[model samples]
Target: MAARPIIRFPDPRLRQKAEPVVAFDAELRSLAKDLTEAMLAAPGIGITAPHIGVLRRLVVLRLESDAAAQAYLNPEIVWFSPETIRHVEGSVSMPGVNEEIERAARVRVRYQDLDGVEHEEEAEGLRAVCHQHEIDQLDGIFWIDRLSKLKRDRLIKKFEKLQRLGA
Candidate 1:
């Protein structure tokens, strides 16, 4: 599988909700592989199909570089702990800046494997953060939306400046 091009911030597709993955076929597996490759190329720990312009509720996460990547299909948060934690978060689509965002410290996520087998898992700390972040992406909510308007505006300006300089 090859890494696909990632859509950048402000792309309308990023704001559009992703459709659920209905097929548990080779194509879905291939997409999972592609997402994993693209995420590694982006040097990101988590990614969603929407990041690559595929409107599918699919996510790939590899919290540790040396660890194997895990793919989640149609993932949804089933429960969240009241305890919250603030972590710095960024997006592959919006590459140059990150903001501290508050999220559930623990979560119970219900998702399906590539084979369409349903599974539920509990996560905390970074894993929990990644789950919420990517799930928000799947729902067309950019990570910056979690920030204050002032912070979001400042971060977008910074990102735009980075893009101009990089170009």
Candidate 2:
């Protein structure tokens, strides 16, 4: 497996909606492995295909304690709890910045596994947050999108300047 480069924010590809997987073939399976490697190289807990310019409805998530990686294809949130929790979230695409956001404390997600088997799993805490974040990527949304317009604009400007300075 190879580590794919992550596309950063402000890239137009990040705004495009991802396509669903039509078949769970060898290529898709290999892509899942590559995604896991990429996520691990980024040292991140979760990653979506869009981050690597695949534009496919795929995501890989591995918590610090997990021995095996988890792959989700065409994942959708079927249920979410009314209770919310706030946590500091960061993205490898938007490096060096983290912001606090409120998210559902629990969620039930349905998705196809690497072998084409469909499964539904309930998640909470960091796992739930990771699922939500990856699902947002599939929908062409990012964590910063949850911020107020003013805050979002300020962050864009900051990142833009950083880019200009090659920082």
Candidate 3:
């Protein structure tokens, strides 16, 4: 498996909704493997297909320190808890800055495995946060979207300046 380059924020491709994986064939499996490798290489807990320029409904996540990495195909959150929790989230796409975002404390997700078997899993705590974040990426949403308009604008301006400086 190879590491795929992650597309950064402000790229139009990141705003495009991903397509569903119609066949659970070898190509799909290989893409998932490459995605997993890319996530691990980036030292991140979660990654979505769109982040690597693949417009497919796929995600890779490993929340627990000792848990094995898992890939999700056509993943979607089917249930969410009333309880809410807030955490500071950062992204590989954004690099240094992080923003506080509120998310559901618990969630139930339905997704397909490598073998194309459907499964529903309940997640809580950091796992829940990771799932929610990755799901948003599949929908072309970024963590900065959760910030206030003013704050989002300021951060974008900062990134733009950084880009201009060739940094």
Candidate 4:
């Protein structure tokens, strides 16, 4: 599969909620492949279908130390820990800037594999943060929304400047 171009920030599609992936067919598998390639090409740890305007509840993530990539279809966080942790978060759509965002330190997600098999997994630390971030995106919530209004405004301004400067 080829890498798909990521739709940039301020694109209305990014705010649109993704539809659940119902068919676990070859086409879905191919989408997973495309998302993985696109994310790796962006040098991002995680990406979702909405990033490329597919509007499906799918995500591909590859941590810095991972030996393989992982894709989740129709992913949703089933549980969240009371403990909160702050991690700097950014999106492939909104490149060149990031900000600290607080989220549940641990989470258990219910998702399907490319084959449509349901599975639940527990995650912590960066993995947890990444999962929550991607799930939020799937729900039509951009990472910037997790920030305070002041921070979000400031970052949007900075991001727009970067866009204007072709950075």
Candidate 5:
């Protein structure tokens, strides 16, 4: 599979909610494969179909190089823990900027496998963080949306500067 082009930030499509995956077929599998290639090439642990302008509720993640990459179709977080943890998060769309994001320490997500088989599981630590992050993208919630007003303003300015400087 070829690596899909990752759309950059403020692309408007990233802000649009992704459509649910209705058909679990070879096309979906191919898209997932392309997403994995793009994610790995992006040097990011996680990515979503929206990142590549597919606008489908698909996410591919490889938290550890030693572990197999996971593809989740129509992934949604069903529960979250009261405890919260802060982790640095970024996006392939944004490239170089990342900030500490505070998210639930654990989450229970309901997702579909490649064959459209339903599965629900709880995740903790980094896995939990990654799940929340990607799910947010599916919901049209950008990671930077978690930041404070001042921090977000500063980040956009920096990102704009980078774009201007041809970063």
Candidate 6:
């Protein structure tokens, strides 16, 4: 599969909610593959269908460079630990800038596989953060929305500067 072009930051599609995926067919698999390829090419550990302007509830995560990419369909965080942790988060769509954001330290996520098989998984640390981040994106919440207004404003300005510099 080939990497699809990623929708960049400030694109209105990034703010639009993704539709739930209903089919567990070859086309779905192909889209997952394309997402994985696009993520790898972007040097990002995670990405979603919406990153490429395809508003489907799908996410692909490769937590480590050598690890196999995992695809999740219609992923939702069913539970979140009261304990929180802060981690630097960035987006494939919003390149060249990142900010530290607080998120649940652990989470239980219910999601379907590429074949539409439902599964639940517990995640902690970085995995947990990624789940919440991606799920938020699926819900039309950009990562910066998690930050303080001052922080979000600063980050957006920085991102805009980078864009002007062609970074």
All candidates: TM-score: 0.97, 0.94, 0.91, 0.97, 0.96, 0.97
What lDDT would candidate 1 get against the real structure? 0.94
Which candidate order results from sorting by lDDT in descending order?
1, 4, 6, 5, 2, 3
User: How far in Å is the alpha carbon of 36 misplaced in model 4?
Assistant: 0.6
Worst 10 residues of 6 by lDDT: 59-68
Q: Which candidate is the best by lDDT?
A: 1
In candidate 2, which residue pairs clash? none
Score candidate 3 by TM-score against the native: 0.91
The alpha-carbon deviation from the true structure for residue 165 of candidate 1, after best TM-score superposition, in angstroms, is 0.2
List clashing residue pairs in candidate 1. Answer: none
Sorting all predicted structures by TM-score, with the top scorer first, yields 4, 1, 6, 5, 2, 3
The alpha-carbon lDDT assigned to residue 154 of candidate 1 equals 98
Q: Write the per-residue lDDT of candidate 3 for residues 29-113, one digit (tens) a residue.
A: 8898888888888778888888888999998887667477889999999999999999888776766567788999999999998
lDDT of each: 0.94, 0.89, 0.85, 0.93, 0.93, 0.93
Model 3 stretches with alpha carbons more than 4 Å out? 161-167
Which residue ranges in model 2 land beyond 4 Å of their true spot? none
**What are the per-residue Cα lDDT tens digits for candidate 2 across 1-167?**
35889989878888789999988999999898888888899878889998888999999999987898899999999999999998888777877667788899999999999888999999999899989988998998977998889888888888878778886
- Greater TM-score among 2 and 4 belongs to 4
Q: Per-residue lDDT for 27-116 in model 4, tens only?
A: 998888889889989989999999999999999889987898999999989999999999999999999999999999999999999888
Total clashes for model 4:
0
Q: How many collisions per candidate?
A: 0, 0, 0, 0, 0, 0
Q: Which stretches of candidate 5 lie over 4 Å from their true place?
A: none
For model 4, the stretches where C-alpha displacement exceeds 4 angstroms are none
